[model samples]
Target: MINDKSFIHYLKEAEQDFSGWDFSYVTDTGRMAASLLSWSYGSMAKKLITEATSLLDMGTGGGELLAKLQPFPHSVFATEGYKPNFPISKKRLHPLGVTVVEVDEDNLLPFTNGQFDLIINKHEAYSAQEVRRVISENGIFLTQQVGGADCAEINEALGIPLNQEYLHWQLDFAKKELEDNGFRVVFAKEETPVQRFYDVGALVYYLKAIPWQIPDFEMGDYMEQLYGIHRKIESKGYFDVTQERFIIKAEPI
Candidate 1:
């Protein structure tokens, strides 16, 4: 039984609006943290942005990360496919002189050929052909993807069935896809880092925020498992899970 008053407090905190792609709520609480990979996505992206005159940030989410890359290029553009995030992205990016566009994940982008000299994507799906269509000749494409098997341990912990969709979303598969789309793969790396949750409430908040991790997640339905996991946390200090991540840099051939 979850008898502690803190348990209810954390559960309520986890149920708030996760409108943007931000995770500061859980992260700031020091309830959860992940080990870093060998490479840094922000550093690499900053270097590329410094050199490009025109740039595009796909799936810019609330433009939180993009906003930090200030002193931007002459032309900076961002796209958000999730409708709820569109207005958020615009509000955060528009004042920075970044054009925030609403895009359909499955459709072609609205720009003309060779529109941007650099394109950056982080944890967003893209149609390779459409990316090729919009990028200028010799343009650079940098993307950091969340591997399909990311956080599979979470599913295992909760006795949830694993999905097959992301089984092949590793670095090699991403590189091959880009090459097949006429992009010359320049750099690629993959890492499976360990993440630790200090409390059951953190795990609950995470699953609730990123629903895809546990598509059918519900406190009522998984109460037994949650209680079991809570007991484990009380004994072990934390719950550990692995997260898959990969980064690829390419250029149109």
Candidate 2:
């Protein structure tokens, strides 16, 4: 172990309290950034909300994105699977006339059949059958999912095996599942954009922020590899990785 002060400082700087699916600390400071996709989920959701009477936001983390698209429909609801985020979602969305529910299992939604006409999900898992049951006949189910291959390069960098469980989670796989669940797909697209980290600290922070990226990750376990990445960043200026994203808009047939 190097046990150097500079390295310790980087780890200390990276050890930040991340909450509500927010990564502004590193992103806003130019330490790390991801290339923009051709489509914007917010713009699409905003337009959908204007047309629908009832809306459901699945996994409304901290209600960050949902709150931005204000002047919501008559019945607005949000569901969060994470326990910690349930309170945060309620506190932020409740006052705005949004009913936030805590859902432990995505397959079993605690809602009546045909309860919503517009359902929007970002980076959240859902059962197509359950969605079809809860959404009205004319309902729209729009989702933006992170592919199983999302940032796998980071795993390779750290000498960690790719998460096998999620490795096959791609656009085609998702689209087929929705279709099988009695949905007619309208719009669908996929993208693998570039994501760059300018420093080792930023990478550390990002890995910490998203624990699933490296399951049970600890600074001590990857010290040497991190130091190597630190040297590479020092020489090459940035560590680049591919980010997988896909969008699907479907309606019940």
The candidate that achieves the highest TM-score relative to the unseen native structure? 2
TM-scores of the candidates are 0.95, 0.97
lDDT of 1 by residue, 175-218 (tens): 98889988999999899999999998889988987778898788
Clashes of each: 0, 0
Candidate 2 lDDT trough over 10 residues, lowest sum: 1-10
Model 1 CA deviation exceeding 4 Å by range: 1-6
Predicted structure 2: lDDT:
0.92
**Residue-pair clash count for candidate 2:** 0
Clashing pairs in 1: none
lDDT of 2 by residue, 102-148 (tens): 99899999999999999999999999999999999989999999999
What C-alpha lDDT values do all the predictions have? Answer: 0.88, 0.92
